[model samples]
Target: MNEHYNRWLHHRGLDPDLMQELLLLSQDEIEDCFYRHLDFGTAGMRGLLGPGINRMNLYTVRRVTEGLARTLIAQGDDTRKRGVAIAYDSRRFSPEFGAEAAGTLASHSVRVYLYPSLRPTPMLSYAVRHLGAAAGIMITASHNPASYNGYKVYGSDGAQMPPHRVDKILQALAGIDELALPSHSLQDGIASGWIKEIGSEVDTAYYNHVLSLSHENNATANQQLKVIFTPLHGTGNRPVRHILGELGFTQVHTVSAQETPDPDFPTVSAPNPEEHDVFTLALTEAEQYTADIVIGTDPDADRLGLYARNPAGNYTAFNGNQIGALLLHYTLERKAAKGELSSQGIVLKSIVTSEMGRSIASSFGVKMEDTLTGFKYIAEKVDRYEALNTPFLFGYEESYGYLLGSFVRDKDAIQAAMMCCEMAAYYKQAQNLTLTEVLEILYQQHGAYIESIFSFTFQGKKGLEKMSTLMDTLRNQPLKQIADLPIAQVKDYRLGIDHLPKANVLKYLCTDNSWVAIRPSGTEPKIKFYISAVADIIDAAQEKKKRMEKDLRDRLETSL
Candidate 1:
């Protein structure tokens, strides 16, 4: 660790700000930052921006870009010409990091279509497919705090690159041993046409596609629904509002303080839509105007979070599973009503998502499938469905991610925002129902299902070790029962059951249709516990979930 730290400390021509940052870090911080080179994990590369081998900074960014450039070059000239599309969110250093990536790719004679200004991750996915690019680069940390940043690579299909392809990129990245490599300046790349600037044309195209998803008769609901939206000071403001406006949604209200892009994300603690705290400002604004829905999207706009007014006139925040169920039901209902539903159509979700989604799909005679636990897996499934000539009706996860149309392969808040408003409006005008009421009806019809999430974060080296031990213990010394419920089955993903790839995940199926899944987060330093409870009623489900969680905590809490 000291040697790694000294290498950067003494390296000539180091970034000046980085050098100052290096000089000030405490001993523990130094060790934390210098212990290892940042590698591509389940997600793409991400970390706090700083001057360390493991940290996120210009040097690390360039190294990864150079690795990507080499990997692209190896794929042959045709792929290189197809280029890479680059987009960024409103995180600090996002633009600089994006420009640097473009310049790096250009330096290798690879073509680049770089967004002129900040845009969301879904736009990058769309740009990749629309331009027929070989791959795409999204410079963002998603919903992470302002101090962190990330670089995610997408395949030509416009999804996060699968693990096998990412493995090649990592191998190429690991082989890079020097920093003094050929590089082109942003100006040089732009002037030489190696890196072309892209905007309005693509934005207009995207807005049009999302708008096209709206049903013709839904215009009345779109106009009558009063909606409040907050981007949480990221990239969703312009495109989200633009689509809503184009759909005749004139009553949309934007939180003025968060309407513009601010890298600092001053209004929220972490800029994550999943957290209720992030919606504080939007909910406040919703109450002032008596808005029907309060919507919030994260930094890169790939995920969405929402709250809707209930029958009693109080706003309620809905978790990811509830929202996913609602969206799945709404889309299928609209399709069935229009005679657009297909017997071969299927809905995709992560393995850990609520089973209620499957019930919704089954009721409509649509198939529902589960992937491991990432949007990339869902994306892969969508590609397969296309090959088999089946339409993908919808895809979602326990996280606030939903994909309606296949145009943009990754999870898209842009689509979620529009459909959410359309759904709320349609129900409001036709059924005289609030989203809360509709949700209850679905629950009552499709067995009351409840899901609870437990995340224990383990930071740094020791934390990683602890997580490994915990996973190993649970895998080897498996529990046979929980809360006095017999465990019907146990799935250890490390052995790659269910024809899926090997992953460090464990799932327990109980006799009463309840289940629990334990796995470490691919993107963050945390282990997540997903408990899904199913029963004939909400109270029964809640009680079972409470007892199961308590039992699990009793058995495992001491280890941590």
Candidate 2:
């Protein structure tokens, strides 16, 4: 069977290097590599960057773009003419992939706006709307390991292209039965005026908008604040530093080792900001500089990592929920204090995010809404509110993704970093408190709510099957109790309630103020358990969370 696939791929014109490797792989390795096409869902295609149909290589990139091309063509001449915008991160072959996509679109007579160099994901979202294009493509695997790459699609609205639209693109992808298709050369496309490179103009606009999000225009506070930032060797170096420096953040320091655009991400085990260890170097710099705050963005610059000084003068790290709650509280308090907060103000969060921010919003009389676990859903709500002429104050997910302004339809870490700086300044200068102190204040006001996510990764084809079976068992035969806590409610998102799209997710609410949610990750091969616990005291909340996690994990292990 492996030999059959090897011959088939060689005949289909796969790259010679990849074909050579296919012939050398062990039988089991070949089976794993050729067992299936990398599944392209709402997150687009993401996988290891290597040979085989299951990987993210030139062939798969072109194949996905070809699908997008056919989808756009079917939408009529106007849509095709509006064309697609392409941007890539600082990953291996990212530039080449962007060019391949642009060339593929250009082959179909579609216009293309290609970024000259690596840029962040949110900028691609901004470019889609800024360029008036019908679609956008970002070549990034977000904060995944250096070995992975991805292709993310966006609609004209700047969000990840919604599900209904993705279905059409998938249909187009299914129709392409062969990889050896004639295509236009990148140079020819550029010469023909169909492929355009965009830079500085969009960067300027993005920087200007990010700067404008600093409502607390206390130049003295900003100048006085000490900050340390790292881009984790991805695409955020230039823009993040430029925006901060231009905004009067005079005392800024960066981790020199991780400042350059190196796809290998030599400094960290993973480029993801969510992991505690990714901040090792940044934390070192923070201590050396005695910085008031530390910030790091993932490879694509859409997700942000934050650390701040506590009352004890010790730097403390915050999880995504804590960051979101802080930003939400800061934005609301400042807006309401200045009487700038609208009467129709609303805040959005993913279903899996902590509910602490929800309580904070209520205290400020702002509506708090929950979408499924994706920034795109949050953006969808933002778009609806924009159409309704209502106010969108904030949107965030627990995965370090956040959006503060409507200027960009996806999570903007640049915006988050700016606001976090300003918020830290506000609490320090005006309120005489640190971020940790402000968080304590919020906790006091709304009871202590703690949230954590545990992920179990299963590799290879059998691992995928194991994950699927786990979700199936949970959904088909629901849990009646966990840790002797009675179930208060069960929300099966697959049924699609509360005006949200259907998804394969299960949430079990306990009688106590705690809950557990189970779902497969959209972009990776892992089953994530979202657990949240609340109590009148911080220690009690932490204890409850630990207990819930232990009981549930133990039960899951026994069942397996």
Candidate 3:
């Protein structure tokens, strides 16, 4: 640790602010910062912003980017000439980091296409496909706290890079030296044509593609419907609002406080749409506008949160499972009615997602598929569907990520927000129903499917060891029941069951189709417990879900 600290201390290019910060660190802080070198995993690197080998800073970004440059060059001349696309969110140093990545690639003689301003991660995915780039980099942490930032890599297919490719990059990365890395100036890269700035052309192309996904040309009847939208101080403001306006929902109201991009994310505790508290400001605006629905997108606009007016004249937030079920029902029903639905059509979801999606798919005579957690897996299945000439109707996860169609290979909040508005508008005008009412009807048709996620954060080095111990305990001693319901099966993903890739996840399935899944977060310091309970009635389902969560938490606590 001292060796690393001394090396960093003497590095000439270290930023002055970082140098001052490093100079004041206590011994423990220094150890924390230099204990181990940061590992570049398949998800790329994510960490709190700081001046350390283990933190996110210029040295770390350059080191991994240097690896990416080498990997791209090794792919041969054509791939290198195809270049890389770069985009960023409105986070602190996002644009700077993006420019740094571009310069690093250019330094290695790799071509680059870079977005001129902040854009959603989905747009980055779209840009990669639209431009035929070999890979892409997005320089923002999705929904993490203001202190956090990250770099995510995407493949030529516009999805997060698969493990095999990432493994090769890791191998190249291991041989690179951070301080000794070389970089070209962003100015020089552009002057010499090694880097090109891209904006309106890609945005227009992506917008047109998104508009094509709507099921109808007749959104006129619902033009009067009131809607509320918030970007949560991220990048969705323009794209989402533009689509909604183009679709004739001109009465849309933006949460004034969160209308513009703010790197500090000052209005909320955190910028995550998955958290209920993040919706406080939006809900307040919803009531003021008497909005039929309230929508919010995370910092990168990759995840969405929703609320709708209920019959009781109050706003209610639906969990990811419920929202996903609603979207699936709306999409499948519309397609089936129009005779566009095919037997070969499929819906993809994570293994941890609600089985209610499967129930909906079965009713429509379509196949339902399950992948491991990340959107990349869903994207992979989309590739398979294309190879087989089947259609991908929809894909979603309980983390509030949803993708419709194949134009964008990752979860797209802009696409989701548009579809959500279209669905709400159609039902509001034609069916005389609220989103809450439609959700209840779906529950009535399919048995009530209730779900919730419990997340436990374990921080620091010791916390990591403790998390490993917890997973080991769960694997060695299986639970037979929770809340008196017998576990009919245990699916341990680490063993690669169900023909899926090996992952560190354990799912317990009850005979009643109720389930609980345990898995650690790949990018954050937390483990999540997903509980799904089904019953004939919503109240009973809710009660069962609550009891199961309590029992599971108690068991996990004792195990620790």
TM-score, per-candidate, Cα-based: 0.98, 0.98, 0.98
**Residue-wise C-alpha lDDT for candidate 1, range 71-188, written one tens digit per residue:** 9999999999999999988888998989888998998889999998999999999999999999999999998888899999999999999999988888897757434554457998
Q: For model 2, how does the per-residue alpha-carbon lDDT over 298-405 read when each residue is reduced to its tens digit?
A: 999999999998878789889999999999989988888889998698899988899888899999988999999878899999999999999889999999999998
- On a 0 to 100 scale, what is the lDDT of residue 87 in model 2? 96
Evaluate residue 523 in candidate 2 and report its C-alpha lDDT on the 0 to 100 scale: 88
**Residue by residue across 1-560, what tens digits does model 3's lDDT show?**
48889988998887899899999988888887887766544356788888888888888888889989899999999988899999999999999899999999987779999999999999999999999999999998889999988999999999998777788888988756788887567998998889999869889999999999898646575586788899999999999999888888878999889998999999987899989898898888788888889999999999999999998889989888878888998899999889999888989999999999998999999999999998889998998888899998999999899999698999999989988888888888888899999988888988999999998899877777888988898899988998879999999999988999999999999999999999988888888899999999999999999999999988877767
Off by over 4 Å in 3: 40-42
Error of 3 at 535 (Å): 1.0
Q: What is the lDDT of residue 245 in candidate 3?
A: 84
**Deviation in Å, model 3, residue 272 alpha carbon:** 0.6
All candidates: CA RMSD in angstroms?
1.2, 1.4, 1.2
Q: Candidate 2: give its CA RMSD in angstroms.
A: 1.4
Please list all clashing residue pairs in model 3, or write none if there are none.
none
Candidates ranked by lDDT, best first?
1, 3, 2
